[model samples]
Target: IGGGSTHAWCQVYLPGAGWVEFDPTNGIIGNRDLIRVAVARDPNQAIPLSGTYAGSPDDDLGMKVQVNVICEAVAGDSMGASAS
Candidate 1:
């Protein structure tokens, strides 16, 4: 984890591919343009915020998030399965 007043999240793993990044922080997933600092032994260790503040604490923090998943038809991908 790094130092800041921020938030972030990760993605589930695929069979062939390794862990891809999914930002619950910014509602973005597998965005190659975004930067990934580091990963950890466990997901809990990868928070974007973890530090102390020296100044007087008087400010408030609030955040909002949204995610959208769309599925479209693709060639060569089977939909139905045959049962014996």
Candidate 2:
């Protein structure tokens, strides 16, 4: 979403706090604005876009996808703040 493409985030498990989410693209430290579509150890395991096309090579004009993200405020949640 930062550079007009699909954004990626990560999650790390802590000793006592459990698993924490981090969005490097937007500097977000929580899941307030993120959706857990898939979990994988390697980035390739989670392909954002994939499909098979059937038609003439010249007839293919390519494909385009548009994503919109809507975030809502959570009361008493300070972890949503951007991490430094």
Candidate 3:
């Protein structure tokens, strides 16, 4: 697993490929263009030391994100996963 302030993702080693990344956070699959910094057993280990620093003793914070999935059919391919 790996993570950064901008993105976090995990990878599995394949026979032919060193590591295939899968972004559980955003559900994105393999790609070399993806920004990656480190890898570990889990995401927390990839964060920089400063990432855990709090602004102040009394500071509080919350975060929220939204994701959407859009699918479409190609000229010669089936649209859904089960299609053949």
Predicted structure with the largest lDDT when compared to the true one: 2
Kindly list the per-residue Cα lDDT of model 3 for residues 24-72, writing each as its tens digit: 7666779654665566787677764434665886775644434354557
Residue 84 Cα positional deviation in candidate 3, in Å, after optimal superposition: 51
Tally clashing residue pairs in candidate 1: 0
**Over all chains combined, what TM-score does candidate 1 have?**
0.37
RMSD of each: 11.6, 9.6, 10.3
How would you order the candidates by lDDT, starting with the best? Answer: 2, 3, 1
22-49: candidate 1 lDDT, tens digit per residue = 7665666685545455567675677655
The best candidate by TM-score is 2
Better TM-score candidate (2, 3): 2
Q: Which ten residues in a row have the lowest lDDT in candidate 2?
A: 60-69
- Provide the global lDDT of candidate 3 against the true structure: 0.63
Give the winner by lDDT: 1 or 3: 3
lDDT of each: 0.58, 0.74, 0.63
TM for candidate 3 is: 0.37
- Model 1 spans with C-alpha error above 4 angstroms: 1-7, 14-19, 43-50, 56-84
| Model 1 CA lDDT for position 71 | 68
